[model samples]
Target: MLKISSDQALQLVQQHWQITGEINDLPSYADRNFKISGAQGNFVFKIANPNWSYADLDIENAALLHLVHTCPDLALPKIMLAADGSHIIPLNLYDDAGNTLACHMRLLTFVSGQVYAEAAQQTNTDLASLEYSLGLAIGKLDRGLSDFQHPAMMREVDWSISQLPGLIDEIAHVEDAEIRALVQRHLHYFADNESQWRQTLPQAVIHNDANDYNVIVSTVEPDGDHAQQKNSNQASAHESDPVRAHYQVDAIIDFGDMCFHLRAVDLAITIVYALQHAVDISRVKQCITAILRAYQGVHPLSEPELRILPALINARLSQSVLMATRAFRKNPANTYILVSQIGVHRLLRQFEEIGADELEQLMLSAIR
Candidate 1:
């Protein structure tokens, strides 16, 4: 990864866009991203990875612009046109060797809110409302993207669930024998069921990576009386209320992983991350049901979609664990990758013990 300094990013923004602001680096795996704050307001400045061609970025920008029209009420980042009146511009930068490198860059309006991963950590927060809102927002996103099409949406992506089987060899890289076998079991299960996984299932453009950090939720301030009542009803809130009473899904970020795929695969990816904090099977079921129940209200899931979820969810977990292991081995000092995989092993084991029959029944109960 080429390190684009904050100074270089600021200089690029000044030259390309009319707005100027202080720039700070944002975490990115394959691209350079920064948050710019100024009088005009905050915005995201992205320098594309050299791997991403102009056509690839054009497809993504097109989808974002399309969603603005299709789901106007949804809080999505709007693409900001550069001073040239183009949404994307080519820029040349020099690496450490002083060789010129070409990259495409763009500016976007920043979507505001607490990231779901951080917001979920607040002990006083209402998990039920947040979980349901997460599902509802994803459901609407898929619905809006249903009619959208692009040549690049079908590009092969390494992180996609459809690529789970291709990662089987990576399982050996898992240090723990038991964990390695567990990953193999799920990957094998996915291979066996590959024929049915996408058979007759609805396919469309989906925000495939709904990981906790990529989605943002807005927190609602509780009035004095509401706060008092919330304390009293904390226990029952988990069972009764399905409304967005405490928190609401404000934005879904990082369109880098968006692709054309099975719509249910999108929901399955959401379920995997939604259960990251679960300490037990009961809590897992609670989160799963809340998401399913809310999602069905917006876009109903077919019988086939519901049945394949356990496998897809497990496959995704397996993918995460395997990929994390490979990444950690290469960079032992990056503990964040290891930290992200904390509860995945436990969740995968729990799902294995629950088995497909009962898991399917549990999901059925949600929509019933």
Candidate 2:
């Protein structure tokens, strides 16, 4: 699902280069790729063929291009526009257009970096560095994009949070008691905190999907211990563990899911996915602190934003369920759905495990 063999991409590349007098090698990559390297150096050309139909990715292209020019300090991709001023290769809308052609396709300069997922396989001290680096990187990114005044590129789709209240009715549809209880409890949790959560904050542009897997860790000393070890996610996360060794976060990847949302929403997305995926919760906290400190260091949170962190956690807990249910809604045999199921359960169990005092303490730690 990541690639296309269409000559349209190749033709587009050559046309842009021929017109601009830049040369490149045959683009190679997984999924839809126009990746190239040669006399013109390396450049990465990716696409955005999303689930959104009817001119969806076009708006995303606009948003990305806007962000690229908006943040001068950050290294985001630049679009390779066609000669006649079209973003994609002659995006011809027709009968069954959304199905034949994606909502939009794009190109970006290739950034050289390593992924944190691979880093976890290397050294034992990489986690702290990764966390801190992520904090700084995202803090900088968030700050750089703060003045972004553009409307969101895409239309509003169903946020899983909005679907939470109805989970009580769906609980009857779920056969498993644990699953049913998870949904019911999360729904109640969101309802209890809805007032504070809703009025707490408004949406702003954020790197909504800045997962480690979407990050790249590039290096100068390719052969040094810093070679593979330089960009890593390894760590014990105990107080005794050193923190300075893992801070080499160079760049972020996968802007496909970026959106306008509250800052806590971004934090919650990071914490929710990271805590679930990480081997240790302490590492999650370390990463959270690194990112949060970096964020607040630049753009400090408001009192309301501070108040909403825990409620956002619960809000995210509710979100996890609806997200999981959506995956299963159409596919009974999909393994991906089961993964979301586990995430949904894990978030709920965590919610149920925390008492009022502990919840307050957790919120304080998160905001700190």
Candidate 3:
């Protein structure tokens, strides 16, 4: 990951896209991101990781275009093409060690909202509606991507649920013996059932990672105006209305992990993150029911899909902990890598207590 200075980012945007804006550096796991505020409109300028090739970036752009056309109501980031009409541009960048590397650059329209993690803390936030809205958004996103395809969609991504078997070797990195055993049990279950899922489950290109930070939340008043509106009149109305705002998932970002997989895997990923916020098993069940019911309202789930949710959710949690463990090992100073690991051990235990058969029944009842 090469670092791009704010000055360099501003210069590159002006030189290539012919647009100028004040650059605000944004934190990213691998790539460099800058929020560009200009008179025209705000946008995100991205410098891709050196490992990303043109095909990888193009596939993502193509999918966004497809969704923009197919699902117009959804707030999705549109890829901003360069002056020459290319979505991707190759540029040579230098690291601190003075090594030159070729990387791709992109510009995208910025979609604004408070991140879900931050929004969940507000006093007036409606957790049930927020969970349902998240489910509906993912359902529509998966449906819009059903017909979309590209050669890169077949690429093997490390984060895909189907690749859980590969991470089994990395489980040893988890220091706690109890947590390591829980991860081991789930990985074994995933390996046995993955082949069957590949054969029977409906497949599609999925957003894949819908973690709290990747989702954007916005509040809509009963009068239909959004909280994002800057009108002083609207602000006063919201303050005086005595009505609670409805929290909805307005946008999903960070498609870097997008890949082709079981459509049910997308729902499983959603359930796992939603459960992360739960205080107990009862709340976990509530979150699962809310999401599954809302999702089925848009795209119905099959019996087999419902049955597999418990195992898949467990497998995803294991993947998250293992990946965070490995990344934390490499950069011990960055404790943020282990943030997602909080309460994961307890969540996994809750799942075990519920057991798979009873969990399947809960999902079955949810969709009914």
TM-score top scorer: 3
TM-score to true structure, per model: 0.90, 0.74, 0.91
Instruction: By lDDT, rank the candidates, best first.
Output: 3, 1, 2
Per-residue error for 45 in candidate 2, Å, reads 3.4
Error of 2 at 340 (Å): 5.9
Clashes of each: 0, 15, 0
lDDT values, one for every candidate: 0.81, 0.56, 0.82
Give the distance in Å from residue 133's predicted Cα in candidate 1 to where it truly belongs: 0.7
Task: Kindly report which residue stretches of model 3 are placed more than 4 angstroms away from their true locations once superposed.
Answer: 1-3, 222-245, 333-336
Between 1 and 2, whose lDDT is larger?
1
lDDT of 3: 0.82
Candidates 1 and 2 compared: the better one by TM-score is 1
- The segments of candidate 2 whose C-alpha lies over 4 angstroms from its true place after superposition are 1-8, 16-33, 47-55, 66-70, 85-89, 92-103, 121-125, 158-179, 191-202, 219-247, 340-344, 354-356, 365-368
Error of 3 at 258 (Å): 0.8
- In model 3, the clashing pairs are none
Looking at model 1, the pairs that clash are: none
lDDT of 3 by residue, 248-306 (tens): 88888888889988888899998888777766777687778777877787788788888
lDDT of 2 by residue, 81-120 (tens): 6556676653332233334643444556677666766774
lDDT of 1 by residue, 1-368 (tens): 66578988888888888878888988887788899999999999999887788877988898999999887757999999887799999877666787777889999998888888887776656776677778788888888888999888888777877788887777878876777888999889988977665666788888888889989888765445334434432243343444434677888888888787788889999989889865678878878877787788788888878887887888889989978987898899999988877789889889878887899998787567
Top lDDT prediction, candidate number: 3
